[model samples]
Target: MDFGEFVMARTPALLRFAYLLTGDSHLAEDLIQEALVRVHRRWSSIEYQGGPEPYVRKAILNQYLSWRRRRSSAELVLAELPERRDPALGAEQIVERDEMWSLLATLPRAQRAVVVLRYYEDLADQDIALLLDCSPATVRVHAFKALKRLRAALTPTAVAGASHGRA
Candidate 1:
């Protein structure tokens, strides 16, 4: 596919991937825009490398990591009001998802990226490592550490209760 067609097909998934990485819609949009600009400049080289999606994804990941490093000292602000919920879903589910996002946000950028790429993107260790320019072992370590932090933040009892409630 051509560059425009590739972008049209992949933008939604890319945006979702960015959102999962940054946990902020605005940041995700900015990240994608920055990445796409870089990708556009090197579209021919990227296309020659094979499919552009992987290249674009790697660009997005790099952009996010760089942005995080630059903004390390900045404070993150959340909206005062919660987002509107779907009436069909239970309040418990919304709370659980929000709590999960909050916990994810507390993780270091590398750990958070690994977790999101592995779990949300269903990427394997080698793929994640390639994306982050790290060893597979490093990816595993990040995932383990991130999961440990998440577990400590949200107890098993709470997870079980949430699951049970859903059932």
Candidate 2:
């Protein structure tokens, strides 16, 4: 497929991947745009090689993983925003979903990326390791740590304490 066709077919999925990595819709859009710009230059070579999707994905991942250090000390808090309620989801489900996103936001960048790749993207550990340029054991460790943190935060006592303003 040509570059335009490739982008037309893949942009939505790419945006979703970026959104999972970023947890911010605008930031995800920026990442995809930047990644597309970078990939456009090498479109022919990438198409000649295995495929463009992997290259574009890598560019997006690199853009996301590196954006943290490139920016200032200010951080984007994605947890709280004025968004319209989804009519299809019940209040409890919305709360759970918001809580999940907030919890994801708390994780360190690498750990969060690993979690998104392994679970949300449904990638195997080795594939994630390759994408992150780390060993499979390291991927497993990050996944383990992310899960551990999520579990600790979700425990009944922990939730109760948090609700009671007890850190």
Candidate 3:
């Protein structure tokens, strides 16, 4: 497909991927914009070399991994998330999702990216390692550490104990 068609079809998914990577809507938009601009310039070669989806996705991931993106990184606060709710998800599930997002925000960027790529995108460790420019063992370590933190945060005793310590 042509560039425009490819963009129209993939932008939503791309946006979601970026949002998960950056955890901020505005940053995600900026990532997509920058990635697409570079892709547009190389469209002729990319379209012929391989499918644009994977190429564009790798561009977005690389953009996210770049030093500039990490230079002034900030957490996307829970207050910044929209108030809308999905009808298909129960209230408990929604709360769980919010808690998960908050917990995920606490992770290191590389670990968070590994979690999103492995679970959200369902990519293998080797694929994630290639994307992150690390070894598969490194990717697994990130995933292991991330999941460990998530589990610790999600444990009932931890949550209950945390709340009790608040006041």
Candidate 4:
């Protein structure tokens, strides 16, 4: 496939990643469009430099963070977004993902980026550090803290559900 085809094929995944990052579908679409436009404008410049997805990813994150810094409402208005239900997923996984995403939204910008990059994007610590312009150790620490918070938030719910199931 050619460059445009490759980009078209990957745009949905990129938009989904942005959606997960921002939790706003509209903003996610806009961000993806903007990121792709920038990438397209510099495609030749990026094509020779290896995979450009990382560059696009970094640009999206940086743009989001910058917008957050300048805007009054950095948080996405996701109150109306209903959780996606999957029949294949057991109740626990469904609840866990939702709860985890909720807690993730509550985290500070940098911590949220770390968690999203590490888990959602499955990027290595070094990759996340590079994207965030931080050290690998700092990425590890931020990921550690985010996971700790998620664990704390989810554990009680799990325990209560287990107890209720047994009753």
- Candidate No. with top TM-score: 2
The 0-to-1 C-alpha lDDT of every candidate, in the order given, reads: 0.83, 0.82, 0.81, 0.73
lDDT of 2 by residue, 1-167 (tens): 88888877777788789888888887786777777877889887764346777778888998888875333344323323324457999899989988999999999989999999989999999989988999999999999999989998878798677679954
Question: lDDT of model 1 at residue 52?
Answer: 73
Give the least accurate 10-residue stretch of model 3, judged by summed lDDT.
74-83
Model 1 pairs whose backbones collide: none
Q: TM-score each candidate.
A: 0.80, 0.81, 0.77, 0.71
User: Which tens-of-lDDT digit does each residue in 50-156 have in candidate 1?
Assistant: 57788899999999988843333333233222234588888899899999999999999999999999999999999999999999999999999999889967797
lDDT of 3 by residue, 13-125 (tens): 88889889887787887787778878999888764445668778889988887737533354322322333467999899989888888898899888989999999999999
For residue 149, model 4's alpha carbon misses the true position, in angstroms, by 2.4
Best lDDT among the predictions, by candidate number = 1
Q: Which segments of model 3 are wrong by more than 4 Å?
A: 47-50, 67-85, 156-167
Clashes of 4: 0
Stretches off by above 4 angstroms in model 2 are 47-50, 68-86, 156-167
Per-residue lDDT value at 162 in model 2: 69
* Candidate 3 clashes between residue pairs 3 or more apart in a chain or in different chains: none
Model 3 TM: 0.77
Runs of candidate 4 exceeding 4 Å displacement: 1-3, 68-92, 155-167
